[model samples]
Structure formats: C-alpha cells, structure tokens
Target chain A: MADIKSPVPGTFYTQATPDAPVYKAQGDTVTVGDVIGLVEVMKTFIEIKSDMAGTFAGYAVENEAAVSAGQTLAQLDG
Target chain B: MAERSAIKRLFIANRGEIAVRIIRAAQGLGIHTIQAYSEADAEMLAVRMADEAICVGPAQAAKSYLNIEALVQAARDRDADAVHPGYGFLAENAGFVRAIEAAGMRFVGPSADTIDRMGDKVSAREAAQAAGVPVVPGSKGRIETLEMALAAADEIGYPVMIKASAGGGGKGIRVAKNADDLAQMAPQAQAEAKAAFGDGGLYLERAIQSPRHIEVQILGDGTDAVHCFERECSMQRRRQKVWEEAGAVCLDEGIRDKLCASAVALAKAANYVGAGTLEYLYDSAANEFFFIEMNTRIQVEHPVTEMITGLDLVQEMIRVSGGEKLRFTQDQIVRDGHAIEVRINAEDPILQFMPFPGQVGSMRLPEGDGIRFDHFLYEGYQIPPFYDSLLGKLVVHADTRAEAIVKLAKALDELSIDGLKTTAPLHRALAADISVLTDSFHTQWLEPWLEAGNLTATP
Candidate 1:
C-alpha cells in the first residue's frame, strides 16, 4: 500500500465542478499519470495525478476538504 | 455617545497579519476576540491566539473570508458583540457592514452608508470635491459610453487612467495613452471589472506620472477626526505596496501640514469612524497633491505610523468604535523619528513575483531594539496557498531616515524563510538600490527596476 500525497495547499475537489462526476472511486483501477483530483487555490486549479498504478483503495480527505502540501489524499493498494 | 464598552467579545473576520494585529489590540482593551477562519487557516497563529476561533466556510476566499452571510453567522455563533473586518475582504464592503449591523452586533469600522459613499470611486470623487478636497483632474462620475469616456479622456488630457468604480487589489485598471488606446482599453477594462468585481462601472482620471504615493492615517469618532501625519509608500510593484516609511522626508513642513489637514477634512466629510487611510498622489515637481482614494480600515503599514507617533492606532480605533472619542489631538500627535516597513511575501521575483505556495520549513525573525516583525509563520507551519501572498512584515525605526534604512537592511539580511521562496531577496536588493537608499523612488519605479533583474540575492 502507498499513500498519495497532495503537492499543493488548497481545497480538494473530487470532481471538476459541482455537476461533474467524481474523478475516481474506491476500488477503481488506476494507472500512472491518470488525474485523480483537483486542488483549488487563489482561483487557480491544479490537477492531482497518479504516480503509481494500483487499485484506488480510499480517499483520506472528504470531498471539498481543505488540504496542505504533502497531506495524504488517497491510498493505492497493489 | 452610546456605551461601546458593551463590546466585550470581538469577532475578527479576517486573517494573516491584520487579524493578529486586531487580536492583540482587542486583547489590550480587555476585550476577548474570536477569529473567523476558512478551512485553510486551521493552524493560523491568529486562530490560536484568539479567545475563540471557528471555521466559517471552505478554503476559497469567496466562500469564506468574503462570504458576508457566513461571517455574520459565525459572529452570532461565537457570541461576539462586535466584528472587526481588519482591512481586506469585507473591510470596506458595505453589504457586509450592513449585515453585521443588522445582526445586532457592532461593526468595528464605519457605518455601511459611509462605506458605500467612499467605496464607489466616482461618488468618492464627488464627495471629495464637495468637501473642498482636490481630486484627480478627470471624470465627474462614472462614464457609461465610450464616447463619453473619450470625451472625458480628452478633457483630462492624454495618458488617462480608466478605473473600475468598485476595483481593489490592483485589478480592473487600464492606462490609456491616446485616443486609440482609450478606444481599445475602455471596454476591455469594463469587461474585466464586471467579471472580477461584478460591477462594470468605469471612470477616468489623468494618470499622475511618477507621483509619490503618500497616505495620511486618520482616526474619527463618527463626528470628529484627527490626522496621524503621513507615510511615503511609493515603493510598490504592480500597484501593491512593498516598502513604506513614516514622515515623508521629501515633504516640507508646510506641505505636510496641508496634506494631513486635507486628509482629516475628507475623513470628516465622509463621517469616517475608526482607523482609515486617505491615499494621495504627490506631484513633487508641481508642488501639489491630489486625493486618490480612501481605505476605510486599518492599513498594513499602520505600525510605521505607530512607531513614529507612539500611539496604538488599532487600540484607539477599537476605543472610538466602542463609543469613545479621539484620544489625542493634532497638537499632541508628533512624528518623533523615522520608521521603515518592508513586506515579505512568499513569491519569487525572478518569475515575475510568482506565488510560491508551500510550507515554511523554517524561519528566523530578526530581533533587536527598534525592530518589529509582524507575521503568523511558524516552523513546520503550512503556508496555505489559498490566500494572499503576504507572509510577514518587517518594521524598523531610528532617529533619522538614514539610520532607519541601514537598520532595515540589516534586519532583512538577518531574516530568513526556509523551504518556500520569499520576496526577502527582492527587499534586500531594494535596500541596496541607490534610489531607495536616497528616498527618491516613485510609485512606477519598482516594476521596471525588478524587470531589470536586480533581485539576485536570496535570504
């Protein structure tokens, strides 16, 4: 198991917008370079991408949760 | 006057240095403070220092600090008797002031009507003109059509400024050099204003070329007002003040007296209460000054004034808001010496001052007599990326301007913020710049100097 950490400090959004679908779900298959979530700060958005391929275990932060740099956001289980 | 001592619990509806400043002042007044924060500010020092703290909304500024309803609700929930908007976000917001008032809690600044009157640039201009204050030479009020705008531009002469009536934070402003530029920029500026501020109201003013940016600090009790002298803050980049000094040495005593008196006049005309600032453009060559705009809250550089005057402006503001009158008269106020302030932000000057949002791995605040550092940063503290880039302020005082500059430069050299990039290097370069050392720089000088790649040192 590996912890996915956020690289920026902002509010984590599981979806692109309010009307969009969640970028990833529990037990979903993931691959390296796949975008998982977004961090919104100062009106700018940065995409959080996967670095290692694995199964999406669970999210550490809730939808629209505030996060800081290096804060764990998700878990990947092989 | 109604009793303001009734305000025992104060709600600080802001964050960062200003929030900390207000908290200390309120504490000194024997009033407890509650810090209203967004989710992003969970570890902010202000939150920890306040008597009580609560998260009002999400991380986004619009949903948190700028959200009027959320802030008011937090005040109610915290059982706060008054709310201090603390300079930004909702500081000059009329709707926020009105909402706070409607909740049966005192808003620490001026009334909503006063905010509305001074917040609208066009109306503020009219008010200044009505009060015998000399405003910039353009635009009687908001100009609706391009033809009218061009007409005003021509009358004000070329190189006019097209400004959003509701603009702040350096947004929604365009400088037009001629008729063609005016035609091209007016509508584009209008669109941006509407998009950013939700108010597209545009007005024009003759650009005061290379004017020294000076502002007078004032305190009022909704009836009487007194001036706290002036600060020379021409050292700005992209319209944001970076370095400020109290007691502009360039000003002759005669001009200083007039400028401060005029500031008091404008504040009284607006019925301004609490601490506020009236910005002006000083045309040194022309030997005249013109009113620019008034900030209806405490300023970031308030300590510079405080150091020279030996008065606690924030404390006085709270006392006045609590139904007290001005504590000191004009005669009692005196500029004892020179003071300088430099703002350190989490930005890289080489990358056009790009915001470097991250955790502050470590920091060393310089300490000495006549030196003050106002910041919320702590070792291992997450410098949140969601808010303004300002990380801290370094203020120093001395018996003379020369000594003050030397002390400021030395302090900057000692100050360090590890992990994240800082504008400290830029400030270090400024401290070395001959123009800054000589106190001869103008408002438009810093950007070009920065573009010349002078900020090379990293501290």
Candidate 2:
C-alpha cells in the first residue's frame, strides 16, 4: 500500500470547492499526477496530486481537517 | 454634550500584527486588553500579550474572526467598553459595526451608514464628486446594458475600465481599449460579475495609464477632521501592496497641499469618525489625482504615516472613538522626512510568491533609530495557514527618500527570521533598483520587474 501525503501544513479538502464532489472515491483508479485533493495554506490553495498510480483505498484524514506536512492523507493500494 | 470617559476595557476583534498593535496601544492607555483568537491562533503572540484572551471559534475565519455574532457576543460577555476591529475581517463590515454598537459597546469606527455609503464604488464616486473631489471621468452610475457601456466608452475616450459595481481585490474588472473591445469585453465582464457577486451591475472609468497609487490618511472626531499627509503604495503585486511610503516624493509641495486638503474635505463632508484613508490614482504627468475609494479603517501601512508625522494613529483613533475631539489642528500635524514600510509576508518570493507557513525559530529583529518592526511573531510559534501571509512590516524613516531607501536596505540585511521563507529579499532588491531610488515608477512597475527575474538575480 502506498500513502499519499500532504505537501504542506494546512487544511486539506477532498473536493475542489465546498459544493464540489470529491476528487476521488474509494476503490477508484488513481494515475500519476492526478489531482487527489487540495491543501489550503496561508489563504493560497495548493493542489495535492498523486505521485504513483494505484487503486484508491480511502482517505486517512477527514475532509477539511488541519494537516501537517508529510502527514498521510489517503491510502492507495498498489 | 455627555462627559467623555476613557475606555476601561478594549477588545481586539482581529488577529496577527494589527491585533498586537491595538493591544499595545490599549495597554499604553491603561486599558484592559482582550484579544479574540481562533483555535489555530491560540498560540499567537497577541493571545499571549493581551491581558485576557478568548477562543472565538474554529480554525476557519468564516467561523471565527469573520463571525459577527461570535465576536459581538464575546465582547459583551467580557464586559468590554470598546471593540477595535483592526484593519481586516470585520473592520469595514457595516453589520459588525452596528452589532457592536447595538451591544452597548463602542465600535471604534465610523457609523454603519457611512460604511455602507463609502463601501459601494458608485456611491463613493458620487460622494467624492459631491464633495468637489476630482474623480476618474466615466459613467455617472452603473451601466445596465451593453449599448450603454458602448456609449459611455465613447464619451470617456479610449482605454476605459469596465468594473463590477460590487467587485473588489482586482476581480471582475476588464479594460477595453476601443469601441469593439468594449462591446466584446463588457458582456463577459457582466457575466463574470453575475456569477461571482450575484450582481451583474457594471461601471466604467477612464483607465489612467501607469498612475501612481497614492492615498491620504485622515482622522476625524465626527465634527472635525485633519489630514495626516499621504502614502504612496504603488509597489504592489497581484493588487496587494508590497511596499508603502509616506509623503510620496512624486508630488510637489503644491500638489501635496491640494491632495491632502481634498481628503480632509471628503472626511468633513461625511462627518467621518475615527481614522480613514482616501485612495486615489494620481497621474504624475498631468499633476492630477482622482479619488477612487475610501477605506474606513486603519490601514496596514499606517506606521509609515505615524513614523513621518510622529503621531500614534492607533491611540488617536481610540481616543476619538471615546467621544474625544481632534487632539491637533491640521497646522500642528507636521510631516518631517520620508518613511518607507515593506511588508514581510510569509512567502517565497523567488518561487512566484508561494505561501510558506512554518514554525518560527530563532528571530533577530533590526533595532536602533529610524527602524520599527510591527509583527506578531515569537520564537517557536507555529504560523497558522488559515490566514493571510503578512508576517510583519519593516518600516524605516530618514531625512530624505534616498536616505530612507538606504536605511531600508541596511535594516533588511540586519533582520532575520529562521525556519521560514520570507519576502525580505524582494525588498532588498527593490531598495537597490535605480527606478525605485529615483522614484520613477508607477503602480504597474513591480510586476514587470518581477517577471524579468530581477528577484532571482543578485544585485
């Protein structure tokens, strides 16, 4: 299993916006460089993209939760 | 007339450096200080410095700093005598002012009606015109149709700005060069405005080419007003002022007098209370200035004015809010020397100004004469990522603009904040630039300088 970690310390969101759908779902296919979520830091949004292709397992952190840099956000099954 | 009583308790309804600024002013006045913070900001410097601190809500500003009900309730419960909405969040929000006043606490700003009137672009333009202040010639009011925009563009001449009536922060604005451009761009601007602000109302203004961004600072006691000179904030990126200077060297003494007088006139016309700023777009070639809008709160660049004028604006504003009269006449307020303030934001300037929120480590601040640093940072403090990236302001003053630039460079070299990237290097480069040294730049100058990799190249 490969884990997707946040690149910055901020609040992580599963969707592009408050009213948008989740960028990915459980058991969905993940490709390299595919956007998985967003991390908002200091009022600027940075996209969190998948580095390795895999099957999306589940989000390890709750949506809109404060996260530290290098903290695992989602689990992916290789 | 009622007897004036000094505020016994002052509650700060904002965070970061400005909060610490208000707290210091309140403490100096022997007022009990109360600071409000979100869960993310509990460990901030202001929280530690205030006499008392309260957690308002969650990390998100919408649930905390921007929440009018939470802030008002907190202030009332604390038995606060006054609330200081420093600069942002609810500083300009009329509803917050009304709620604070309704709670029997002084809001420390202008009345709600004044905020509402000055907050709208069209209404503010009308107010400026009525006060005999020059404004950018364009539509008298909102242009409702494409045909109306076309006609207004024709009258205003070429290169007119089509802006949303409800827009701010450089959004919902499009510049049309000619008639065809106006016809094509107006519809798109209208549609974007409708989608963004839920109001597609648009206005037009003659776009001044490479205008200097100058603003006048004025303080009023509801009955009288006085101008505290002007600040030039033309060095901006993404419409955010990166560096600011007081007593803009670009204006001659004659034009400066007229500009400051017009600002005071507007304040008197509005019967303005507390501290406010009248923003203008100045055309250096024509020696003309047009009032654009009014910010009815203390600004971030206020220190430059204070540094040059030797007046504590925060303390003065609070005194006026407590039913005090203007302390000094316009003649008493003297501008000496030149002051410059550079914003030290938590961003990597080399990386296109990307936000960098990290824990503050060993910090070394510049000290001595003519140098001031206003910030809310402490060793080992973790900067919360949910807010703006402005870490602090490094202000310097000297006998002349040239000397101020020299002082800025020296102070920038002395200042250091470990464990986080900052925009200090950007200021270092700007201070050494020839155009900046000669004061021969405009509002559109900084972006091109950055785009040309000036920040990356060593001076």
Candidate 3:
C-alpha cells in the first residue's frame, strides 16, 4: 500500500488539537480522504490525507516534528 | 532575535554567492562565521569558507533556505549570536525576521516593523509619499473589486499599471494602456500576484513611458543615513534586471540631488537600518521621478555600487547591526570611478530565457585588479533546477563609463564555465552595442534586441 506524504515543508502533528484524539493509531483503518496528519508552513496548515484505503501504520513523525515536502508521514498496508 | 551587541558568531541563512559574500564579510570583521547549507550545497564555496558549516536540509529551497523554523533551530543549536539573511529566501520576510528575533537571535538587517512596512508595495508607496518622495499616482488602498480599479483608473487616468500590493521583481504587474486592456489583464495580474507574493490585493499606478529604472543606495544606523549615488538598471528582461551600471546618465544634477535626498528622507522616516535600496522611475521627458519601492535588504546588484564606492556594504551592515553608527557622514562618502555588473545566468537567450540547469563540466573565472566575480559554480558542480538560475555576477570598475564597459568586455571574455550554457555571450554582445554604451537602453531593450539578433553582435 502507498503512504500519506506531507505536501509541504512544515511541522507535523498527528491530531488537529491538543485535546483532540489522534487521527490514527497503529492497525487503524483509513480511507482515501482520511486526514492522517497536518503539515504547517508559514502559518498555513494543510491536512495530509492518505491515498490508499487500508490499515494505518501510525505517524512516522511525532507532534511538532519538522517534515519536508514529500516526506512520508504515515504508512498504510492493505 | 537576540539583542544587539552580543554578536560573536553569525549564522548565515542563505546559500550560493550571497552566502559566501556574507561569510567573507563576517570573517573580515573577525566575527566567527557559521554557514547553513542544503545537501546540494554541502561543498559550495560558502560552506567551505565559513568557520563552521551545518546542513540545514535538502536541495529544494522550501526544505532548506525557506525553512524558517529549521534555520532558527540551526542557529540555536550552533549558539549563533545572530542570523544574516543575504537577500532572497527570508531576507525581506517580516514574519521570519520576527521569528529570528523571538528565538533570542539577532536578524542582521532591517527591523521587523520596517520590513513589514516596505515589504508591501502599497504601504511602501504610502511611506514614500509621506516622506515627500514622489510616488507614481496609484490607489492609496487595496482594490477589492474590478469596479474599484475602474474608479481608480478614472481618477488616476488610463495607461495605468495594475500591480500586486506585495509584488517584487516585476511579478504581478500588468500595464493596461486602455479600458479594454484593463478589463482583460486585471484579474490575471491579480491571480498571478496572489500566487507569487501571497497578496492578491490589487492597486493601480500611472504607467510612466520610457522611464529609466534608477535606484539610490542608502546605509542607515537607525538614526542617520547616507546615499551612495544611483544605479541605472534599465537593461532588463521580463522585469528581471540583467545588466546594471552606476551613476545613471542623462539624469540632471538637480533631479539627482532631489532623488538622493528623497531616498535618505524615506529611510529616516522608516528608521531604516543596514543596507537598503530605494527604487524609482525617472521620467526623463517630464524631468520628474516617482518612488517605486524600497528593497529592505542588500540587493543583487549591490556589487556595482560597492565597486564604485569602495564600500563593503555587507561588512557595514553587520557593524551597524552591532550598534555601530554611520561610519562616514554625508560629505565623507565619495563616489569614485564607474562600475557595471552583469548577471551571468545559465540560460539560452535565443530560446525564451528558459533555465538550462545541469552539471558544470569545467569552470574558469576572470581574475584582475578591478574585476570581481561572485559565483558558487565550479568544475563538476551541478546547477540544480530547484533555485534561481543566477550562475554568477561579473562586476568591473574603471576610471569612466566607457573604460568600465571595455574592462567588462575583457572580463567577460576571460570568464568561462563549460558544459552549461551561460549568459556571458549576451553580456559580451550587450557591452559592444553602441546604444547600451551611449546609455540609450530601456527596460524593454533586451528581449527585442535578442529577437532582432542584436545581442548576438560579435564583441
């Protein structure tokens, strides 16, 4: 299965907010439109979505970890 | 950013020739230098010359130079006392400047407030107007609707220029000679401006015909300022300046005095610091000058001014940021000799200036008493497509304009970078042209000249 990648260079976060539940955990199922993480750059936040409909392998980066463009934020397996 | 006066080690947040320029300037002042490099630039001259070099990120500018948080962290990790953004990337970014300051590191350029004011074209026009600097007639506020632009056109008159409020380097600019042209070009200009500069707000300005793009160089210490003559940057292609010369010709002495004085006045009004440039459109027919914008940091053509003034602007910027006042007063500064700068890019002028980025098989630069070549390319070096196509800059100074042109021709002949096409031939050809020599060239000169086989003239 393909992976969800960061569309831009920025800090990555698994959840939308501090109090919100994580979007995905290990072995969780995901769809094409599922928001796996958020990539923030220059104060603009963009949602990183999975392309493959499969089981989520959790985030490669932790909260506030810097990520580059095209960096794989999460892996998926059918 | 860190407080002033504590700077011992400066982390240069850029790459290529500008990065090397900053590092050398810092080393000359006995300040320890740190260079931030992308993976592609790990072996560049700037990285090798610095006291220490660290890989900030990969090749793409967004991953490297434009990564503000990464740059700040790199500075913090290295314990860098200050950060010097040498044009491009985050040089004029007010938010980046603020972030650098907030990280307890100094940004060795203009204050964040000044950057915020001048970074935007609309506000810069207001600042210039408030300082009594002549400004092109334009809308004082953002035009939210096409009707608003139409109203502004009626008041400012037709043949107006539609520009993005946050534009630079000729992007987001559309000249509508009539109402029909305005109706078609306005929205396209706005969309491009929004994509390029992140500001879609449109404004209108009276488009001055045959205007010479002249700019005054100024150095300020937040309290005092001085002018360093002017640069004629009319030789441009697609709004990107290709060739520049010091001390514009045909500019009356009275108009020169007024332009220089107005530039200083604008700087003082902003409490501007470090090296800055005030651009203007000199309408020779009307004998009037209109302020365009103020570049908040060192300019690409800064070497031409440096060649004529014998001033190390980069060093002066660092010193001034460290609390050093203006070293030379108005009278103390003297203009000497003539200088010209040509941007050598890896592109084909015969084709539509498309970037020819690739490996540099062999490279040899000119060396002489008054020839200065600023570049990062070398034998085996790869010119990446991820950044600007500026391969190098060739600058020469001589006793007079004619002599400087001759020296430039020689310097261009002596310089060679193999396996990659460069604009050297274009500079050589342009230098030999009598029109360019006689200072009759305009902003629209290059493309037509190239199209007409004029730039292919043998040197």
**Which ranking of candidates, highest DockQ first?**
2, 1, 3
Model 2 chain B, poorest ten-residue lDDT window? Answer: B1-10
Model 1: per-residue Cα lDDT over A1-78, one tens digit each: 988898767778888889999988999999998888998754457789999999999888998887877999988997
lDDT (tens digit, per residue) of candidate 2 on B204-299? 988898999999999999999999999999999988999999989999999999999999999999999999999999988778899999999999
Candidate 1 structure quality by residue, lDDT tens digits, B1-459: 254566799999999988988999899889999999888788999999998999998877889999998999989988898999887788989899889889999988899899888888878888888988888787877887789899999888778989998886556677898999999998898888889888878889888779999999999998899999999999987688999999899999999989999999988888788999999999887778999888899999999999999999998888888788786778998889899999888877776676788778867789999999998888888778888888889999999999998999899889988898888888778877789878878999988887776675433
Please give the distance, in angstroms, between residue B176's alpha carbon in candidate 2 and its true position after superposition: 6.9
Sort by TM-score, best first: 2, 1, 3
For model 3 chain B, where is the 10-residue window of minimal lDDT? B349-358
What lDDT would each prediction earn against the true structure?
0.87, 0.93, 0.85
What DockQ does each prediction reach against the true complex?
A: 0.43, 0.87, 0.04
lDDT of 3 at B133: 93
Which candidate achieves the best lDDT against the true structure? 2
lDDT of 3 by residue, A1-78 (tens): 667787656568789987999999999989888888876543346688777799987677787776766788888888
Model 2, TM vs. native: 0.91
Ranking by lDDT: 2, 1, 3
How would you encode candidate 3's per-residue C-alpha lDDT over B1-459 as one tens digit per residue? 333355789999988889988988888888999999987678787888899999999765778899998999999999998999998899999989899889988889899999999989879988888999988877868986778888889888778999887775566578898888888888888788778877788889888887889999999999998998899999988788999999886687899899999999999999988999999998877788899899999999999999988899999999888877888998887888889999998786655554566678877789898899988877887665556778789999998999999999998888888887788888888888889888887777777888887755453
Which 10-residue window of candidate 1 chain B scores lowest in summed lDDT? B450-459
